[model samples]
Target: MRLTILAPLVAALFIAFTQPAQAERVDSGVPGMLFDHDVPVAMNDGAKLSINIYRPDKPGRYPVLMLMGPYGKDTTMADAPAYRTSWAKLIAKYPDLCKKSSCRYIRFEAPDPERWVPSGYVVIHADVRGAGASPGVLDPFSPRETQDYATLITWAAHQPWSTGKVGLLGTSFQAINQYQVAALRPEGLAAILPWEGAFDQYREIAYYGGILNVAWQFWWEHQVVPNQNGNAGTPLIDSIGGGKDTGLPLSQERLKDNRIDPVGAFARHPFDDAWYHERTPDGRRITVPLLDVANWTDWSTQGYLAAASRQKWLRIQTGDHLTPFYSDQALALQKRFFDHFLKGIDNGWEQEPRVAVQVRHRDGTTWRNEKAWPLPDTNWEPYYLDAASGSMGPTFEAAAPAAKSWPGLGEGLTFTTAPFVNETEFTGPVALRLWVSSSTADMDIFAAVRLIDPEGRDVTFMGNSDPNVPLDLGYLRVSHRAVDPANSTAWQPFHPHVAAEPMTPGQLYPVDVEFMEPTSIVIPKGYRLALTIQGTDFGYGPGAPIVHAKDYDLPDDSHSGLFFAAHPNRDPALYGGTDTIVTGGKHASYLLLPHVPPRS
Candidate 1:
């Protein structure tokens, strides 16, 4: 939290990177970016709403870069883990950012107008009603709140000196609302760059492959929900934003609100009903020119920029978490997109290739560009899970198999292979369909799809989250697993976790899990695919450690680093996710991957 000016002189730093004529600190005297302010706008339903504005300079007309999220925009992110991660990264990486821009004057990052101002961009950061400075009961991305966003845009476009042009940009929640508001067809909206925004609400949040992403829920309840307006964390009549705290507060009575019940809600419905569909916007409605960005190792891969590549003009890249945004190469790409779209300059960006990917390999660094996603002519290979023995079954030679289980009740079934002979490349969506049963009403079907080399070193690489955890893995929950047939294609089945149907203790039911759209990893010929099915959480290293979140502890952390909060059985055999097993056949289960062919 030490604010250091990278440049010795404020006067010197002012014009160092500018046109020299009129560069200044451009101060609004707002101590922190957390200001409770609002500009009333009209919604489609004739409802008038107010939005908080974070500006580059007060009372000036500048290009607007707007972002919205569940977090209270009226409060600064300086104290939050999510904001801290981005701030520490941004401030450290871009020393010039602290002084060169308004990073030192940051609050909630994506919506911080302070940072954008030095770059001459006006940032309209708002608290969704029921969140921060805005008024209304918080519903958190519900259909009603979305209307407020649409109205916010329409109003922002009409302000004098506005030029009626607006640009949307942000990551995660920030990136997501851009799509939702854009879908509203706000007239003043010009361009939007949504980075790694979660498109599928169910698959990304309520459940990851059916298993509830406990970390996400934990952050929501503890970190985010606690800090909203009217919460103990916010101020009432503070002169911040030069106004009163008008926004509604998050309900202390969460059960009465009924909107944030992650477990209870997800446990009720089992389909991609109107709720999920309403939350997700069709990429087609987003006709305005856009630049969608995705991280190679994003922690919350909820709002992944997967289907985005199919859009005409999207930009994809793989970087270590926040590196892409901080690094020179990626920033250059962002500048190009902004210059072309916002500045109305001919940056020659259109001539560039559509997909700018960091094609990862089993080795260290990897980068590649392409004109399309899942590039045409991709090799589709299927690796079957043969249950009779502990090897991936041959497609045709395998005879129908019966049920089998791991020794302990919750240990899970493991399948491995002898090392490969050549460098094999596998990428894209990896799907798993299993006819599974559990002794309890509900169970979590965990999968560890790994790449092992010939010597069996167990290939591991840095993931988007904790660098300690390996990247090659995905998970799912059986009760929350319900696929959207419309979105489920040949290679992957996108699950809608809106509802839950707990498992039959001993009856078979189909379980579909969608691994994120990953890279084409070239595993040497001697390498193999190791899929381990468990009844618990994943481990980072041997002896297993709980994959703790930057925020909350998992439900149950008792079993080998696995945090299980739901319920615990006293007897090891009764509650432990032991005696887990796997079975494969025409009607049972198997691994369905993009099985890419070896490229020249």
Candidate 2:
């Protein structure tokens, strides 16, 4: 922690004097926009990062908006197969896109230079170490990489055309890096708009809920990061500009030496160990203003609930992971935030609601502004479960205890509530409290929350990894359910996931599994909410589309595989046993929810 605090001060001074006052400038002759390609920026550690600058063609200072990630800096939105699928359609949706020019220089997640340059802002994009033309090892999300990002922010602040103020923006890869960099408290980093990214690399990405899912490891290491390796003829670099002409490239040996084995590293350290803690953000140290945006569709929203900052605003949007970043409503709100902070504009941002949520329903969505997350008006209620009847309701009999047992690999039990008499909304995080037992020493709990329409059809929404996923999902290795009391809240239980405390065979243990992803749904008169508790990952029935839309080529497969299959905690030799759900009397099992009343 002290390292993050101390490095920023030293780096700040170095940035002030390193860059030339009026060194090199390129005039695009396109009126308001100028392009500076393959600009080499030096880092404190003697590494030169390949950066591209986009700003007003005229000679004047402007606030800088920057992004740094492994995705090659030369990777254009038009060249990537995943992005080309919807780039044209997405651009058409936002008429404000490239309002001044053709927006030809837009990257996958970076802001459109065409729109920002004319607005008196500079947009800088960089390829971090071991990626693209940048030399060094690709240690994604490590402290070294974070320091490199901090240095880049300071370097931008001292540029000839800079206002000495910087802000970070981008989605997914770009957004996820902001948390770690901000934790360092970079000198010129005035604000951050982390539009839907995970703050905790281990729990959120490497091993979700203490279960190992190598799909991401395989996808990222094999395709995404390698695509941007510091090789001479990388496809992205070649497409943007001749690879050899862009920047200096490293030899094959250097690229391999710099890269870390993410898959092997994850499998080696199954628990929340020092490696993970080092890479994760120290949220308590963050002091900059934050406009964190997440979506119900992307269940990957732990950061929204975990981020700690004095000037922070949370917005929950609807749609897939990429949709929120491209939405017109989201873009305007982001511009307003950056305007107020980086540009020092009197945009009335301080008066805006601290939390803005877009609640979803079967037919459409509704926007609501509140003073805080888990609105002060939230009515915390519990729906008790009856194992004997496989039903859930407001109350359950306590005298007669009932227990239901299911195979560790089976579908398990589902409890649904009675039809609602009036429109009621279930908003915010949810958790399940139950007394569970495993025939073996361990059991994996996979729970999902879904809505059942009057016609008895299941309601699905877009998920960060899968298109048609349940409203919310939770996972817990019964033995690893130890909560970090300091970080845990009633609505969102924080499982340290530091180690596994194997269960006593056939012995019931009380535990709470909290679904970090928030759900906002209105239950109409005839609708019901269902809680499905299963042992394996949930899957859509036969004939159902694997995903609802053409999604970005993220490596994580959230659709049909058991997250525990590759994990030691779920070893068949020790895990394939019957799990029992005990309910009633002393062992009261129930689902806790946030019930929000309609606005007056």
Candidate 3:
């Protein structure tokens, strides 16, 4: 603390002596920057919203850039007593952005006005309703909030300073809402840079492969939601309803009413009933050019990558979730995109490739460039699941055989591979063909594909969320394997995922499961890959962060715990029995990989 106090003063002296006193003057209302006024924008509802507008004084008229978030609009560092003391430290590195255009309307998570205003742009930040000064229910990420998004874009489009071309930029929830609003097709909504956002609430937030994600959801409600309203120590000093969401304090009844039981919502609709159907972003409805960003380490949905890959203009990047927001390269890309789309500037952004992915490198740094998503000429190869030695490989020639292993705790099966010494790239989606037997009516197969090193080590790569994640895994319940043949083909495997059908004690049936898409990873010169087959659900670590819901928690059960019944909910000790044993020999099994040819 003591050193920091003297450090800035000493640095000032060093700067004055080492170089010219004025290195880069910024206009943030500081010696290096400037400020602007807080303008009020009216929403469709009676509630009013406040905006902190940032612009350069020397500009006649400039293209406007806008951001809408639940954070406060007036809560810039200019008013925070503690923030002022620490402002210089942050401003030191970002002098121009922190000081831009008199700094009147500065907010976090935005490029400094001094950086963009001089480039002929006006930045506007809006505090979402139920936050800052806007009024109404604080049900965040709701259709209501999304409706207001379209309204704001249209409102911003007509502003005197705006060119009727407004683009959106933000990360996390900020970016997710852009996808939702864009689906609405607002009149003036031009483009968007949606980064690290998942569109499906079911897969992204509520559940993963039918497992409840209570961890992040619980924390979000506790810490993030409260401040979203006019809570203490929040950014954006303005309140909803022009201070109503903040005025005379919100009623506890109203606050309580806004609380959402996310788990309960999902529990009610085990299928695509009403709740989930309403929450999912209508991707088919979205028709805007997007600079979509994604990270493998993002626990959020990678569906956007799949969604944008289908679009004409998209950039699917891979890095730590937060890297692109602050990285020079990402910012430069965003600047150029918005400059071309919103400002009508011919910045050559249109000629940029349709997809820009960071081909992951072994080291932390990534190789980035333009290419077709799923790389056009992918090799769709299939490897089978042999129920012996618990392996995954291709079936050569199938000979008559006895019944395979049971569902749970039974013999795991087998297959083989002519080990490849050359490196091969596997990109795109994966599929599985399984012939199984069961003693009961239903069965669940936990199928995971892994790369086994020549040294017999399980190869784990950075997944969409975890660095130690496996290559690819797919789940299937025997009865639920009924595919929508109309939608089911080779590349896309559509499952009904509806009811559970019991299996004949010794009947043999074929089950097909498709693994979600993953980028290519070189299998190195000498490596043998393997797949894990199990009946039990997959959960790791102290908390086991994932919880799968089953008929065991149905209305008749009403509660969750160890099961002890039969008929409907069978007793595990008796009929709940399963044969998870795997047996492999000859041409019984194999794994299919969509292999991409090595870069020339």
| Cα-based lDDT for every prediction | 0.55, 0.74, 0.54
Return the TM-score for candidate 1, rounded to 2 decimals.
Answer: 0.76
- Considering TM-score, which of the candidate structures 2 and 3 is the better prediction for this target? 2
RMSD of each: 9.7, 3.5, 13.0
Q: State which candidate, 1 or 2, has the greater TM-score.
A: 2
lDDT of 3: 0.54
Clashes of 2: 1
Least accurate stretch of 10 residues (summed lDDT) in model 2?
A: 545-554
Worst lDDT run of 10 residues, candidate 3, spans: 557-566
lDDT of 2 by residue, 1-600 (tens): 323543445733354334553324555556777777667777766777777787887778899999987766666666665566446655655666656456566667667666677778999888887777676777777777888888888888877788999999998778888988888787788999898877777777677677776666655654455454555645454444444322456677766676887766788888878787777777777778998888665434566555677788988876656545766666688789999999989989999888988887766788889988778989888888899888887777452699999888876899988888999898888888888998899888888887787777776665654556677777777888788989887777788888889899989998888565678888778978888887877766665432222233333343532132454446775657899999888898888889998888
TM agreement with the true structure for every prediction: 0.76, 0.90, 0.73
Count of clashes in candidate 3:
91
Count residue pairs with overlapping backbones in model 1. Answer: 41
Taking all chains together, the TM-score of candidate 3 against the true structure is 0.73
Against the true structure, whose lDDT is highest? Answer: 2
